[model samples]
Target: MNVPAYAGPSSVTTRSGDALSLPAPRQDSEFSIERALHERRSVREFGKTALTQDEVSQLLWAAQGITSRDGLRTAPSAGALYPLELYLVVGMVRDLDPGVYRYAPAGHKLMKIIAGDQRHKLASAAHGQDCVADAAAVLVFTAVERRTTRKYGSRGVRYVHIETGHASQNVFLQATALDLGTVVVGAFEDDAVGKVLQLPEGEVPLYLMPLGRP
Candidate 1:
């Protein structure tokens, strides 16, 4: 992965070329959990409007942002060995370049792994699901099983899957609250996805959630 760090004009670029400084996640909102749950549904069709930077920030925060001072994430991990990694496939987000970005939850920042719209390739990797390309952005979830397996034995695999469900659900409810449409797509060739993103070693792609306006 290319390491050229970047930052929006508003913030100074650090030595790591951290792409964008994410807006602080809102802690309170008028949207309630009950409503989000009731309205939540898989959205395959999306509008052409580009999503705002804040929206992108919120979704990443929901997925796996730091929620506490103790380093606990939004999702519970086995032995607190957070092994999940999030990648944002930006297609039509406002003030953001199109590219594959690695989410650094610690700084609430994104590091561009590569540039260009890889959504169509992702759609192809996902067996021609157009939604993969149509959406404004996709939040890709990957995991390092060894982080948990080292301590919990093979049962750690089960824990990681369970944590994925928790984290993805957070994405679902957060999208609903933000009035954004999204779907968790699991049907894809793992190796194909790995190749498309040129994922680093030991990072296994798990879920693909495309987000957009309905």
Candidate 2:
């Protein structure tokens, strides 16, 4: 269960010289898990309200936030080989610039990858799904197969996908708790998504969850 450390640069600068430090995630939530599960639904439509930075932080944290000091995430992984990587396509988040950002789970920060609104392009890649473009933000889950394959061989691919499901479900529950809406989108041209995110080699796109106020 020896997961390798993340290989990307610790941080990246925006055109405005701004760093990607996110608001501290609130540990205490009034929303109960039972309520979250009961209220959770596949919401394809979204309101125009912009999400707050704190909301974004909580959502990311729920998806893959570091829970233990030893670098374990909120979601379980096969052999602790966490192959899933999180990227955000932000559009209308308050106090945060719209751009593509990679989540650093260990550090609880985001690294800017590309700046500008790419939601429209992402929507096109998702077979013209308006939810991808209309939501305030989209969470893209990608996986580096070798992270698990190096240990479990071809069967590792299944492990990676299973892990992503766990993470995506975490987002769904969290969004419900936050009174936001989200839908897990698996219909997309994989290659098209990779190009839109400018993903590095060894990474493959898996799931896209668009989030916003319902």
Candidate maximizing TM-score: 1
Superposed Cα deviation of residue 186, candidate 1 (Å):
0.6
lDDT of each: 0.88, 0.88
**Model 2 C-alpha lDDT per residue in residues 1-214, reported as the tens digit of each score:** 2223323222222323334777788877788899998988999998777777788999999999999978888999989888999999988887667889999886678888998889999999999999999998999999999999999999999999999999999999999988899999999999999999999998999999999888
Screening candidate 1 with a backbone cut-off below 3 angstroms (N, C-alpha, C), the clashing residue pairs are: 5-17, 6-17, 6-19
Give the Cα error of residue 176 in candidate 2, in Å.
0.4
Candidate 1 ranges beyond 4 A from true positions: 1-16
TM-score of 2: 0.91
The candidate 1 region of ten consecutive residues with least summed lDDT is: 1-10
Q: Give candidate 2 misplaced runs (Cα > 4 Å).
A: 1-19
Candidate 2 backbone collisions, by pair: none
